[model samples]
Target: MEVMEIIKDAFVFPSKDMKTLLIYVLLSLVAAGFSFFGTVVYVLGFVNPECFMWGGMAVIISLLIGWVMYGYLISVIKSGIEQSDEVPGFEWWENFITGFNNFIVTIVYFVIPAFITVIVGYMTNVYGNAMIVAQEIYLQATYSYMGSSSAIAFDAIYQALVNLLFSLTITITVAVVVFVIFSFLQTMAEARLANTGSLSEALNVFEAAKDIRRIGIGKVIILVLLVIIIVAVIEMIFSALFSIIPILSILSIIIAPYLAFFAQRAVGLLYSDIA
Candidate 1:
């Protein structure tokens, strides 16, 4: 139940069956390969529009594979919630459905934050320009009143630029805060969805809040921080080790599923205490 123990157990959970882990890695490779293929086609398609269709197909295939990967992560969380010691077996259709459910849950959770971010962005990029126009107008009036031709109004332009910079800084800060808060909530929501097999259950903010309360906000934060730190360190190691061999470097993608599995398992373990 301790945060550290949960993290350690989560890390170990992925490797409990190397065969299952390899399946995850192989799926990741397929997804990555298709994604890469799509990118290349898109780039080449810029010169030959006919190639775009192939790129589109690649993208669609990649998305399906990615959905499977995501769904499997949900299963990991479910397994953790159930306190199951064994790895989950793959059910392709079920995984796809779960993955789609997760996508819907994710969109519902973040829609408001995304909308707010867009509004702030519009205000900063569009309405924020009004200040510059007002500044220019003020400068023109001042020049006319002085009985002289209007100049570039360098000082006014400078002040407007400074105001835009200030607005930009504020916008970025708000976006960051919104993303973090919603992302935290979404994580809890995903765990709930995984355990209950109900989309509505996951979307119930009040229910998720109850779980958070039961789990202790401090413990959740600690779990998140530890997982992030561990993933970062592991990623760095993978990058270093893989870079040693150019062709073998692509093997680093294998770690992606491992890290994802570990993190979700941690979330599941956190819920097991209450769920």
Candidate 2:
């Protein structure tokens, strides 16, 4: 199918296959569990230096869990697609098959894309830093003549501006790199699913991948906005509760990370449908 037509068809389905989608989400959660645990452990180490060892353990555990979860997720999606006429299929070994496919795909899809992205990101950062430094030099030179009284103020202002510019540049640079990488992966995933294995076949999928992002970004944009809004509101409400109730405050602290993880995984599943 043509790119637009594939999108139209995908949207027509509109994730009516909830069972399959839910299975995918569950698998994602399973994979995410370890990462979350590791993060929490690492954070806690700030309060207790000795906990660093525990954090290290958490990191190792998380990787193992994430790998297993990813494997299962791949199997579920593959099986569900292959047997679309029936109800969704869920299996444990699908993870292994997915892992194998990923092993091949890593070399095929990820390594080169990642390398190019890193190179592009490095160049962008260098350009951005150069601009910041030049702007700082211009400001410092302009201010040095303005008497010593304002020199300190100008120096502070210059520093702040340079920092902000550097931060903004890094953020935009990273975002573009990520978007490009995601676009590459989206096309590759669809191509893999569609069984377009040859290099020529895969390159053709890039056309569809770009189209998918162009057409489908809007579909899930609202979901992202909603999640951000809701999370902010939830955190605010919880913050208020901490002032009024001590016990629930602690619970909220513990629960917030999981809530964030859940929100991210939920959003991830929606995007995976198109990918």
- Clashing residue pairs in all predictions, respectively, total 0, 2
Residue 250 Cα positional deviation in candidate 2, in Å, after optimal superposition? 20
TM-scores for every candidate against the unseen true structure: 0.85, 0.44
RMSD in Å for candidate 1, one decimal? 4.0
Alpha carbon deviation, residue 246, candidate 1 (Å): 4.7
The lDDT, on a scale of 0 to 1, for candidate 2 is: 0.52
Residue pair clashes in candidate 1 = none
Across 109-181, the per-residue lDDT of candidate 2 in tens digits comes to 5555566556755665655565666766666777666744466666665675676676657656766776665
Clashing residue pairs, backbone N/CA/C < 3 A, model 2:
71-95, 72-95
Whose TM-score is greatest here?
A: 1
Instruction: Tell me the whole-model lDDT of each prediction, alpha carbons only.
Output: 0.85, 0.52
Residue 261 Cα positional deviation in candidate 1, in Å, after optimal superposition: 1.1
Q: Score candidate 1 by lDDT.
A: 0.85
